[model samples]
Target chain A: MAVSNPFVLSTPSLLYALDLAGTFVFALSGGMAAVKHRLDLFGVLVLSFAAANTGGITRDLLIGAVPPGAVSDWHYLGVSVLAGLLTFRFPSRIREDWSPVLLFDAAGLALFAVTGAGKALAHGLNPVMATLLGMLTGIGGGMARDVLLSRVPAVLRADLYAVAALAGAAVVVGASALQLPAVPSALAGAGLCFGLRVLAMKHGWQLPVAAPADPPPGKD
Target chain B: MAVSNPFVLSTPSLLYALDLAGTFVFALSGGMAAVKHRLDLFGVLVLSFAAANTGGITRDLLIGAVPPGAVSDWHYLGVSVLAGLLTFRFPSRIREDWSPVLLFDAAGLALFAVTGAGKALAHGLNPVMATLLGMLTGIGGGMARDVLLSRVPAVLRADLYAVAALAGAAVVVGASALQLPAVPSALAGAGLCFGLRVLAMKHGWQLPVAAPADPPPGKD
Candidate 1:
């Protein structure tokens, strides 16, 4: 079982590095959100970890990979904590502009999407399920962060957020079907996802909302 | 591995029945919430499944149970759908009184807590972790439902909600430590949890909130 565990990634240090970078950036977003919400320092740290690791943890769990890498590896925790501490210490600096956070989030989403699909495929999921899993990985972290803050998940309402992830995941699956190399396929997928997200943000692209006859009541 | 799978529960027909019952009640709560939120039919069904199964799915994932029972078993889906449809069709009848929903929620929480701890123990988790997992299982569903509705999780602020679950889980772990039979131990755990929750609701018991000098900003 140990020999077959794809999460080990002993030879793919680059991919591991990208994963850590994604964790750090997502942690930054989570920490910033916590600060904005006036949560205490401990709460900020918890949000950071939840945002950084939830997607990977969920993917691993679904694929029968016990003790998710985010849990077993100290590096993920270290990166998330570092990002959280930075956000807590310099909230004004980080919160001054939303552009950086948005960019970082897009990058994290792209990385997670491709990586999630590859892992699912490695675990023998069909192409369709692998694609769906990839999108789930991309969106899972933000969804968890939003949920903790008691907000409707942005992915459900944001401009082409989930659609972009699905598109990116589809690219990876398509590449695999064509027998393309993993590195190139991943790069292409990430590029497309990042591009779509940034463009959607810039252009204010949005999915259609259900319009009811009367406005819904304010109370839950 | 098949023989070692603790979730099989070949002889525990009663537990399975109880689990499905818990699922049905929770789904009813979720569907009612969706109707209140003015979500459409699809939204109601989605909330039903999410509210009913999120706890068990999360517990299974953490314990390395791949393809969570909620995903693999048709009965769980069938029960959730039935509850959702019932609520959608008869919102006025089900939502007439809050008391019934609250009681059903407590029952679901109690059932989930003891069963979650029992499963964790069967999977060889330490007593402390198993107890924590039980509490997570009890609260996870409601938290997810509230999050989807863009409201603060009732469990986080509700009267003794998480505390009651933890107490029940602790009782189950204690019984296991004493080598008590599974059936009676589960019954005792559920009884204690249900009692504590109802008492808290009746008496308006609450955990202290952080008293910041300034109120937090309204928007996230």
Candidate 2:
């Protein structure tokens, strides 16, 4: 049986480009996080790779893609390493403004969510699970990065992080179920996710926090 | 093709018993962590499930066991949930002393390391990867639990945690390579891991901390 090499040189296309772009931004974020924590060079690279590849690696693992895509492909590894090095060398450049980071993160989230859902569907998972897995793929890397840094995961607290991913994943799954064209469905899904995230950030939209023990604000 | 049900009612043998026992103890520890963090009931249960099943789930995913052993097996889920509820209700009882929790965690680590290595070898992984996976299985649950709580993972810093797991896994993988009897090999591996962990605790053994930018101790 011939093995499929998804990241081979011959597969130069938009989707692959999007995937690498997402990975680069995520790696930059991870490296920035390491800088925030004052981690050494080794730790910076470790965090960068973890942040860049964890989502895809996790999605692949769950879907039974052995030797996970991130581990198997040298290009993915090269991209992550380069991103880490660049972030380390120009920490101030990346950290000067939080807006760029948020924008990049949103883009990565949208792209990864769509691809994650698409892969899950292709792997024979039920639609609901595929959608959830897609959201997981979008959020998993950030979660892992935060946890390793001993910080609360942004997805569990931030405005519209997972919501955007889920919305994007839903569009992909829904479109696939309805037999829509692949490229258009993917673009639509990614666009919705990105737009919603940017809007949420601009408007300060947030999911309600759990306050199981606290009395109603004024009633107490 | 016939799918194997490893956790069926009829399969209530030693391995099954060990797995359940490990899950229960890990769940208890997770619940304890949640209580310490003052998380709500829902959070406690979520932590419990993550702590109990993450090791096996991670191992299964890496080896291409789709749906994962944790997700597919009802017994494991039930045990983890029950343990969580019990821990939440009796938090005071479990918190009065730390000795029992440590002991239980050590036992779970030992058992999981052996089982993880065995499973990886069974799935035809190379010996080195199999051993590493075994260590990952032993420590993965605790790492997940700590990370979710926004704390540094104990395995990364605690006395001989990952070391003991790796040692146990090496024994299992080595013995298997040499065609040792399964039962005796497993027993030996688990015994070594548990004994090493207990000794490390008693002797206050720890991995050295990094102080990259600091001057030499004498200069300081």
Candidate 3:
């Protein structure tokens, strides 16, 4: 009997890279927002971790992933910590620009949303449920981050963030029907989501605000 | 035929009292915390709704109770809003000492825990999962509340809060098994939970602090 080569590590390595980059950008967004609010260093770090981890945590728990995703992984913690430190060191540079932050935030949302839907599908969730999970993964963390900062969630605001996530999930599900390769299809879906989100921000795309009398609930 | 339903109104009124008081007190706890944190009036109101409604929201959503518990009932919102306004008018006096806040918080936990357990059982969940849902309900709102305030969650700390919620849920389960009256059993559970929490806070009862060592993995 012969052992297989170590080349198989590439798949996990690629996934890990995507996960880390996604976590880092979201954490950076959180840290920068905290700086804008003039929160202390400790507050910035807390916000960063909360924003980077909360969505994945909620998704994992709801989907019955034991111990939850963040608690089960240290890579996420490291990524968030690095981002927090960098944001603190360069607060002025990071906080000055709004468009770039929105772009990076959109990228994080896309990657995480696809990752979430893919994870759920791995666990045998239906397409509808997987889509919901994807939306949650894209928005839950930023919502938690915003509530902690005493602001309305960006997802609830006029943005294409959730729309992009939804579109990505649609791509994955649609691709599955066509018997496309799952791995490459997943990447393409994620890329489409990222591109759409960035383009939306660039073009000032926004969801129509809800009627003021029907203010969205569920913060508590 | 004259429409006369005094018993329908009177008996339901009693059960309504339990939920109403619980909502108001929890709203007060949330509002006072917001004031202490120096949040604006809108902030206090937002926290009040979040803290007062989150446990019920979690319970309803998990049990597939559509429209959510609080959303279906205007009384819950009414009480929370009134409590927020009152706290705003008297922030200094309302949160003068931490005792009342802790007590009200404990009481709120007990109420939601029992409510969640009953709901799960009604929805035909197995006993163990019902207990778990009850626990989630009790702590979920406070977790949301604290996260919004940018603090490490109190439920994750050394206090007996989670324990109290467990006791309340257990009491409900035990009472159901013994065929005790629902109202009386609920009060007993609430009393037990509140007592345990008040005692723990007063005596500074805590889980033993673990000695620091090499931090986990990259934490060092």
For this target, which candidate reaches the highest DockQ against the unseen true structure? 1
lDDT of 1: 0.81
TM-score of 2: 0.62
Instruction: Score candidate 3 by lDDT.
Output: 0.72
- Tens-digit lDDT string for candidate 1 (B43-115): 6766887899899899988887776777556688789989988887777765458799889999998988888
Interface RMSD of each: 4.7, 8.0, 12.6
Residues A1-220, candidate 2: write the lDDT tens digits: 1222222122236667778888888888888888878899989999989998898898877777777778888787888889889878888976579788888889989988988887777666667767877887888899889877867676655677888998999998898778777778888999999999999999998764332342322200
| Tens digit of per-residue lDDT, candidate 1, span A1-220 | 2232333233366568768888998899999999999999999999999998899898888777778889898899999999999999999966579899999999999888888777777666667767877887888898889888877777755677877888888888888778777677778998999999999999998764433334566854
Model 2 residue B30 CA deviation in Å: 4.5
lDDT, model 1, position B62: 82
Q: Could you tell me the TM-score of chain A in candidate 2?
A: 0.89
- Pitting candidate 1 against candidate 3, the one with the higher DockQ is 1
**Model 3: per-residue lDDT, tens digit, A59-170?**
8767766445554356677788799888877765653567778777888887787777666666667778877887788788898877776666768866688889898877
Candidate 2 chain B, run of 10 with poorest lDDT: B1-10
Clashing pairs in 2: none
Each candidate's DockQ: 0.21, 0.15, 0.04
Chain A TM-score, each candidate = 0.92, 0.89, 0.86
- Ranking of candidates on DockQ, top first: 1, 2, 3
Clash count (model 2, backbone only): 0
Pairs in clash, predicted candidate 1:
none
Best by lDDT: 1
